[model samples]
Target: MLTLASKLKRDDGGKAGRASGASDSTHRVSIRDRLLTKEVSELEAHLPSTCKASFPDEDKLHHFRLAVSPDEGYYQSGRFQFEIDVPEAYNMVPPKVRCLTRIWHPNITENGEICLSLLREHSIDGTGWAPTRTLKVHHLH
Candidate 1:
């Protein structure tokens, strides 16, 4: 004999203090966010001396910037910057990376399109992105 609204309320823990609502305390963490928490820590632990990573928004680990200054290379005097964005599909797909600083590299185009084999989703040489690949900052070069 209960109304539709009453039934919904009863089913939703009406005054029983149950966690059936989407409250802030019950915020769900996605797989991507969970993986970034671990990967970001590992990245810091093994960061190279010539490379630096900075998160503009500490809460947003999915987006970050990288600075690279080679000590002994053709671009030794130049410090290059790159933007790395980890999509929601993380391990299933490669991170979208682009060069923020203009450079004339064979692997990178002038418009910031990267040409790394591992970044490719489908590569004929069997070097395309795979789920096993981690966010290894060292492999950026």
Candidate 2:
């Protein structure tokens, strides 16, 4: 018998079992898709008539892109792109996010690792992480 974690690590029949099992993967995917769809819709509806968010591939629903044009700042005219990656444990944990576009900022490292409040590991011992908040990113400027 394979452990639950081990089963989830495999790519073939393993996925099928988990996809149909009682674990969070199945429900996670559905909830994530719905949340993402709703988020995209809301963003589309209220985005400053200039920005946009879209999924490049229909098959890979976990990945999407956002185009932002800061209203103020040195990057005002520059178009910034961000890639969002929704993990299988979504709502329970924040999505893994990184700036795909090259940027220079005190909080953003040269390698694209963002040093934000939410992204910070909670404990100095690295044994605990903060609970996921509803809205992860508010303002990047």
Q: Which candidate has the top score in lDDT?
A: 1
Candidate 2 lDDT score at position 65: 74
Error of 2 at 46 (Å): 2.5
Every candidate's lDDT: 0.76, 0.58
Instruction: Give candidate 2 regions above 4 Å deviation.
Output: 1-29, 120-141
Taking the tens digit of each residue's C-alpha lDDT, what string does model 2 give over 43-106?
A: 4556664466666775455676767887777888888777777776666666566777789978
Clashing residue pairs in candidate 2 (N, C-alpha, C atoms within 3 angstroms): none
Query: How would you encode candidate 1's per-residue C-alpha lDDT over 9-75 as one tens digit per residue?
Result: 5434633454554455444556887787777777766777888888887767789888888888698
> Candidate 2, after superposition: displacement of residue 115 in Å?
1.6
- Residue 77 displacement in candidate 2 (angstroms): 1.0
- Candidate 1: the clashing residue pairs are none
